[model samples]
Target: MNFGREAMMTSDIECDVRSLGDSGKQRAIFAHFDSLSVGQSLVLVNNRPIEHLRDAFDAEYAGSYSWQELEPRPRSWRVRIGKTASDALPRVVGHTSSGDLDRRSAVWSLPIQRRHDLDVTIVTLAPGTSTTPRPGPAVDTLVHVLAGTGTVTTELRDLDLDPGTLLWLPRHTPRSYTAGPDGLRYLRVRPHQQSPVPDSDGPW
Candidate 1:
């Protein structure tokens, strides 16, 4: 919910509409939303219900965007509005280069993209840190090291991770990770797992 100015080609932006009038607010919101390219999003912060804006988007955009409620507070509402490509088209997600990621955080994860049945993520682990071992779900998981170094420990053995190392873990495999001295940055791709509560829809 801490939104600040972003640089060029960033994945997200923010719009705070508390000080604008009704018409001005709508204009500001749509202006930012329209400026976004596919796969980019705008985080809207407002003091009132955005049901009208949601309705307007439904009328004008049809199925070209996604609306998700991020965080709800007693005095403010935070909503994430993401632009998506049409079903028949393809769009670039974002770069996964180590230099492109934020390095200040010791651990972080970025969801690259989510398709009908697939999910992709970029994860970073600080030096010497470790991830808890967990049993994989029914779908297979693919891990590709983008930068730094690490070790992928599976039930069978421990595999070293280098910049180009690609590891595949079958379904139901137990796995964990240990970052090397230089830290670890990797891409993880797997099948999308359905959540009990729908994530894309909010009360609006």
Candidate 2:
């Protein structure tokens, strides 16, 4: 058994509120750990005066917060806790409007739980708008069309995707997307460490 690989699996990204002053100002902290072991827990040392850590993963809730054990697989295998926010988190809100991409494109990132891996985001593209071309880091990605229609063009080929379609692209492969007349919506799933970077080689 290769415990070496398992032992080296730790959260590559972490965000927390670090401090708060008597003046009612708050500070945030973001840390990246090299590796983590199974059964070992990561603690959020928060100095905020709030009774509960605002963004810490809580174990007694559902929907608003969630935590998963990520090891030996890209997907989180265990759900130790769940979401618990009375109101939606920042990432849960829709940040884009119709015909918004041509002016100012947007990406709404959801709360994700992964260790040394990538996660997924549901992206909504405005009608007649397209994404900036770019290659992702060294990781595979799968785009699952949730609603609407679109065309995905890559350096290798072009694919017309609609609801129920799933498109796969490898890392660093140049790619772009154009929304249909009705607009496009899809879930982009990839490794946590390697996200798709915007490429300028193609038109947006």
The digit string of per-residue lDDT tens for model 2 on 1-204 reads 332224333542332334345333222321211122323333332333333433433311224543443232322221122223442343333432222322323355445542224454667778877877786556677878867788988888889989999888877778888888877877777756634564223222
lDDT of each prediction vs. the true structure?
0.70, 0.50
lDDT of 1 by residue, 1-204 (tens): 442332212677888998888778877987888788889988887887665778777645557898877656646777888888543244455677644222423233333222346666677777887777777666688888888887988888999998999988888788888888888888777777676644221100
- The Cα RMSD of model 1 versus the native structure comes to 13.3
Q: TM per model?
A: 0.50, 0.49
> How many pairs in model 1 have backbone atoms within 3 A of each other, for residues 3 or more apart or on separate chains, i.e. clashes?
0
- Model 1: runs farther than 4 Å from truth? 1-88, 98-115, 195-204
List all candidate RMSDs to the true structure.
13.3, 13.9
* Model 2, residue 196: C-alpha shift (Å): 14
Could you tell me which 10 consecutive residues in candidate 1 have the lowest summed lDDT? 106-115
Model 2: runs farther than 4 Å from truth?
1-54, 59-108, 112-116, 194-204
